[model samples]
Target chain A: MDKNKSINQSANKNESQSENQSRYIGVNEWKRHGFQALWALVTNSYLLGFIQGKIYKGRLKNLCVPGLNCYSCPGAVGACPIGAIQAVVGSWNFKIAFYAAGFLVFIGALMGRFVCGFLCPFGLIQDLLHKIPFPKKLQTFRGDKALRKLKYMILAVFVILLPMFVVDILGQGAPYFCKFICPAGTLEGGLPLVLLNKSMRGAIGWLYAWKNAVLLATIFLSILIYRPFCKYICPLGAVYSVFNPISVFRYRVDKESCVDCGVCAKVCKMQVNPVEHANHPECIRCGACKKACPVNAIR
Target chain B: MSRVFRSRRIGILLMAAGLILMGFGIHRGEMAVVFGKAVNICMECIGIG
Candidate 1:
């Protein structure tokens, strides 16, 4: 009877140990999903807009959030930094765009691409789309590396130069990137407002058609690739990447504990090799690589 | 203090300076223009302007 009791106790201990190991396996996934959900809530918190179908135009509209929330979205309370910057640049009486520029610099210096990894509504949308069980396109071609520089060009040309220089017959500069390339505006503002306001449907022209096509293409690409816009086209992301090396909040690796394993590289969605270039400009600081490290070297 | 802490202090100072600059712009009414633009639905941003 004593022997049988001891055997039962040992069995229970083994079962509990197995349960603990299984619980740990689920912990990382739960933490990631929880963070995403919390950020989504924080980003889209103007709940009254969905019910009333009107934008909140209070003092909050003056301040810009770190994430890429559309300023024109009915649910948006805070202003968009990119749109604000473009407006300031396009203004005839433009002095320096100090407010917009300062806000961008502050956010970038503090968090770097942490904003892209966790805060951006469009980035979250892309992340969800990429998880939809389709075969992903991971391997990069020769042109892929060169094409990655396109966002900087877009920033220089559309966001900066065109807004500052390209003027109409009336000598008024236009926000060219917003008019031409921003899929966020199409998804958040155009589609929502057009669906809500019946009168606006008739106003839709070739420009609207072009924007809608861009939105569709972005959505399709995001389903196959991870954050196509963020990786290749988001000017805001381009701005943030420049600060990754000098940002206050950044990833740290314990080289002492790291076993030189390539697991982190294998798991990184942004194609960043953690061991070689943990602070690479292209890295979004997503923490997947950190989680993938077997020796718990990254933080 | 460690070099990391010193770097962090510099970053914080830069961020503070940026905020001050933004505050100056607000005093100069630049933020008001940003607010005005944001309050209205941007037709151009939505591909209608």
Candidate 2:
């Protein structure tokens, strides 16, 4: 009986140690998620915008925030960089989008995809969807290498080229990405506007139906996939990723005192191998790897 | 390592140039047009345009 009790005690000790280690590794990720949620709330805070069911039309609306927020969102105080770029590019006069371009470059150079991981409302939604206790479908293989290139194409075609080239008889170009593709616009602007305004409800047509369908698909995919839009379609993320190799705010790996145990790679939701590719364009700078690193090699 | 340093230098220089051009654009009343469109509800984003 004493031998059996000793065996049970040792087993309990091992189990508790394992649980503590797991909790320690996950604590940083929980903290980072909390911070992301807080940042999203702060950025989208024109509380009256939602309650009154009207967009804020103040002077602040002219500026662009460093996230993929929809300008037409009831709570949005700043313009969307992608939408602003489309507007300037699509104009008949062929004016350069200097302010919008400069803003993106400045922010991208400073933070890289840190903005995507932390400040974007749509990214927040995707992260929450991924946490919904479902069997997530992650493409963490050679296919992801090819899939990562898709966002650049979307950026070039939908956001820039199509908007600049395609025109109506009046020579007015359409904001193609926002009009046909952006689930952010559909959720933040379209759904709210239609629901709140009686006039907008009467005007809901095929276009509205099409956009809502796209939004539904995005929501469904996000539940099973980690940030499907940011992974494969976000033009903004593509632009920011160009600066990942040199962005001021980026991950640093300590090679001197390092042992590559692959813990960082395991914790990363973005599927980046942080030990070798610490600043890979796909790394969202979420700091999960830093927390997961057993040897404290990443900072 | 030196190549990475050079790339960062060039990136900073390019960002500086972009900011300068943006300043010039703003001075030329381009901001007025940008802000004019920004203040209005973007019908195109909601698929109306």
Candidate 3:
């Protein structure tokens, strides 16, 4: 009877302890911060979304927050790194995105998926949308080992190279990704701009139609799949991922405690073969696996 | 026989259907209606709508 009492007491104690830990994986309440405001700037271009409260105070800076924000967002007090790079290219300016690059490096070194999990507006948008009642899945490397490298190609050629090298007849550089390829730009800036301004409608051509098609496809995919942009495309995610291995807030796997049952792998949205490399660059570090582990092996 | 292949085949067909719908709707849907109204109203305006 004494032994039975002791066991029950210990179980209750553990239950109580788990209850007290409010900051555990999914229970944490989101508090508004720099990420939201910055996200608004990156994702929306409305007049209300514009006029950032901080812009008047001279807090404008680049790449500082290490998320994809729209430079053209009305409330933007500071310039977006990608937009800055494009604008710099357009203007034939040398070293235009230096500040943005510096900011990305600094934040990335401090915490890797800390940005992906917390700071990125797009990531937040996907997570919330995913909560809707639907059968969801997480896919892994199937065929085409070469296919995964498409994002890197986007980064090298589409995101960086063409904008820097290819010049318009006016000898000006333009944000090619934003104008031609970026679904984020289309969703955030292009749609809003065209919607509000009647005159901008006539400017609609093949380019505008192309941007709309990409935006529509992304939205459709996001409803079914988990973060199609972040998974297959996002050049910004690719950049920040490089520093994941060394980042301060990293996912550490205690292999000895791990049962290798693939429970963690099954839950991961990024499809990181956690058993191989826990802190894989693809890990947005949503901590679903950490919570899912029966033995609490994944940290 | 191949799961991914089947999905892709269906997906491509869906995409083609979607394009046809969008093309037709571009000339007739709500978006088209809005665009048509805005365009017809202003004969010379050549910008955003």
TM-scores for candidates 1 onward, in order: 0.88, 0.87, 0.67
- Give the range where candidate 1 chain A is weakest over 10 consecutive residues by summed lDDT: A20-29
Ranking by lDDT: 1, 2, 3
The TM-scores of chain A alone, one per candidate, are 0.87, 0.89, 0.75
Please write out the lDDT profile of model 1 over residues A84-158, one tens digit for every residue: 888887877773678988898889889889888888888888887777777656545577778889999999899
A123: Cα error in model 1, Å? 0.3
**lDDT tens readout by residue for model 3, A1-299:** 99999999888876654543333334332443345545655533334633321111122432123566544433433444455444544444342343344445555655665677766766666666655556754454464235556767787776677767787686655456666667755654565556655666667787777778887787777777677777777777777788677665577788899866566676666777677898787887766777766678887
lDDT score for residue A164 of model 3? 74
Among these predictions, the greatest lDDT belongs to 1
Candidate 1 wrongly placed segments (more than 4 Å): A1-30, A169-171
The digit string of per-residue lDDT tens for model 2 on B1-49 reads 7865764785576567767766866776556656766677787788665
Scored against the native two-chain complex, candidate 1 gets a DockQ of 0.68
**C-alpha lDDT of candidate 1 relative to the true structure:** 0.82
Q: B1-49 in candidate 3: lDDT tens per residue?
A: 4864553453344334434543443333223222222212111111112
Off by over 4 Å in 2: A1-28, A139-142, B1-11
